[model samples]
Target: MNFKNNKILSALLLLTLTYTTGCYKDKSNDGLTPINTVQITDPLTAGTVTVFQGDVLRLKPTLTLSMTEKMDKLEFSWLVYNSNGQISLASPRAVISNQYELNYLIQGEPFILGEPYIVRLAVKDTETGVISYINYKVSIGNKYGTGWLVLEDKAGNGDLSFIFPDSTVEHQIYSSRNTAPLVGPKKLELTPFVITDGISDVGKRLYILAETGSQEYNYLTMVKKFDYGFEFYIAPTIQKPTVMTWLSTTSGSTRSANIGIVINNGKAHSNLVGGFPGTKKWGDIALTPQGTTNYSLAPYAVGGPGVAAMIYDNTSKRFYNIIAFSNTPGAGSLTAFPAIANTPGQFDLNNVGKTMIFQDSSDVVHTYNSVMKGDDNLPYLYRYKTANTSTATPNLSISNIQMNAPGILNYTAAASSTNTGHIYYSNANVISRYEVGSNSIVETYTFPAGENVTAIKYAKYNFNDKEAVKRARLVVGTWNGTEGKLYYFALSQTGSIGSYTKQFTGFGKIVDLAYKY
Candidate 1:
């Protein structure tokens, strides 16, 4: 019990007392479990992410901790710092949890294309007084330009012209019928022209056939650029001159423009010494050595009244024709004939007595048979017969492939020998294509919901590995209140139709399209 003994006993007694009462309970790490740190899983980096103008961006956090951990008092605060560096937390608050996702739409004012923005997310533990924060940079842009010029119309005396990516403008060819006025001023007038192989011949001359006022006006129009400036011509009373080809025939005594080898009313007829009387009888004008004129029918004559002709066959040595008409007995009645005869070979005597002349590539004539009738009371196909025979037969024929939907307004068909024959047409809101040979209708494309399509064209363009002469493309023009827009669809090689990677918007209403390559 001396001084040294007393000090040692005091230290021993202190240790014994600490052990018995468990002083280590207050020293162990056990209070609020240190809040197992919060983190944002998405937007892991501090750089920019891009999204469309009206789309949404999601923000999420990755949490890792025991479920027994207290999370009821956790709170989240989202703050957005715009491009101008103004901070605002006007958005609603969220609770932090292990299995929750938060989405934020980066929308407010109209987002300027190609601009950068910043967003921030913060999580706090109210119980422990701890906070965590994260930030991200984002950008917005519109990559697609406008679309192609599908349909073109002229108003207020403006001469319509179209330029390609190279900035070369090709003036539309105006024909004589287009020059004449059918209705008085203030008529909602329009002239439609087709550009053959426009993609290949981007800046070259284009062939166009447009009606001046109505079928009564009947202008077979052709416009092209020769050595001089642009030149145009018009003939009267021709039906839709869908396709044109150049041919050679013996020069005859006809005063009609000397383009030889003319076919009319499904019959091949050369011009007599003088041109067919009146402008009404003039068929499609073919490019001739002298100039562009109606095809010549030497000995035979155009039989029916409506002289509508479309190209049927083309070869290096000769060409064939298909003429659509009505056989009903009347002044404007039409009678279709399918016959085969050698062209520019026989005139005067050899060709004089022949009627309904149509020939195929093998120089064989196809007899026209009464097959079908259209809504206009015209026989879609008349019985096929040889030049002098009247036996109904069917050797080579054309069939009408009906469209899928019925609301088609302004419809047109263009074909390329490269692929199966396909037709494209447009209604008020959508664009479509059909495979004629396969008899399959495909609603291959659609524009923005409320767009109105004016015209559609299919031309041959080279892309990928194949020489695509029959690639289906569409040029659509639409208006959103103030400005007109144009869109182009570059269909896939397999002829799958949709929007192309390229587009051109913000232009006037396109009235016509013509291309020469």
Candidate 2:
């Protein structure tokens, strides 16, 4: 009876349930947005744009895009290529806006004169990953084709040619330009030197000085400036004199910015600038810096800007402690040079009486170094130890005790610190090197037969690598009568000729190689 009562009491206990709830409303609605299309306006036809080589190429395209999405940013890769679709030059990867403009230096291993090239714009949207390509056919004119410039036909006259660095494209640009008439066309035998304003930007007129390989080879008669038209500027009153450098104006928009072009055939440097009709006292080649009335002597083989500039006059057979730019306001005059001249007969006159000076691109002290041969056609390395004071005189001293490259031509050397560098030279049909350091004396690299070297050089063309080691490669100009080559020996960290990198063969007789920035 107790169990039944307990069960009945439990069952009789009534349970009541209640539910608590709140109504909810949708707070937001959304959907993905997308781009429709992108188009390039302006230059609808991409009319021909004639520009000098090494100049800046500005490409600002008006963009018309039909899209529903907001673009975070636009990425662009502007390239200049050939019909082969192989890229020759590429601009930096740029994160751009609608108003972004494209700027690129028209140089590198490609972009030749008189040839058709394509300027391609590969643009992409950061969000959608959609890319648009726009290409333009370009015909270059009067643009300096880069690489090795050959002065061939030393037999009767001379011819100018070029070879690109990639080792594929070579062209006879000079003749194609038909510039002979402008420079007084004549069958000439010359060992020429082409120099750009070392202190100026690219696109500056290139100066060509043709030296007669005759007596002393010191006679540098004609000074030709390569521009839209071949400008024959300086024909010094004193004929048969070599015009070295114009110590180009430190800065200016006019042509007479230089104090004077160092014009001498083994004589005193004429600092006298400015010319008057029938006036023998006038100076044709400006050696005077702008706004300076005083004369400035030009350096023959001189390099470096800040600490010091290495100076050597092949004609004078002398070098100076400092080139004495000493442009401390009033010092730009003849006093700009040292009172005493140092004639260190370190090089041979047979190299067309040519001298070369180089300093590390990254160094400020300007530890200048040079390489040349003497009467024996052998290469020698010379180092310029910086003087404690700028006023102290300095001359290049032989590095190794007796290190010499045998039967060398177009020999060049580059060094950063003392004895820390390498030298490369052309010997017959082979290439060789002379390593310098506090350690070993010299080392040589001999290429196989038929690798005939005609010229040698190393300049600012690091090619896409601004951080590239300054003298990473020893650039050599070579040819086998019909084919020209721009060969280089890549140097190792220890300054040894590590490997044979790349070379361009085609043109003919790569006589010399120089770089414009």
In model 1, what lDDT does residue 231 have? 17
Tell me how many residue pairs clash in candidate 1. 52
Q: Which parts of model 2 have CA positions greater than 4 angstroms off?
A: 1-151, 163-170, 179-203, 211-234, 237-243, 248-260, 268-299, 303-318, 321-365, 370-381, 385-420, 438-442, 465-471
Mark the 10 consecutive residues where model 1 has the least summed lDDT: 184-193
**Best by the lDDT measure:** 2
Model 1, span 5-65: residue lDDT tens: 9999999999999996685665664663544555545535555777644356666656543
List residue ranges in candidate 1 displaced over 4 A. Answer: 1-151, 154-158, 165-394, 398-405, 408-418, 462-473, 477-484
List lDDT for all candidates, in order. Answer: 0.37, 0.43
Q: Tens digit of lDDT per residue, candidate 2, span 1-517?
A: 9999988876665321111111111222234455557787666445765655546667777777776354446777776655543433443333222335766555534665455666677778887788888776666654333444445543334456554445445354454433353232122222223223332222333444344321111111122333211121443444333443443322223323223234344332433222222222213332332333232223243333221333454533334322333435332222223332434443222122333332232222334445544455454455543332344542323232334444434433222332245444445665555545532336665656776666665443356334445345566666666666566655554556555677555545545455432
Clashing pairs in 2: 167-504, 220-241, 258-288, 259-286, 259-287, 259-288, 260-286, 260-287, 260-288
What's the CA RMSD of model 2 in angstroms?
Answer: 17.0
Collision count of model 2: 9
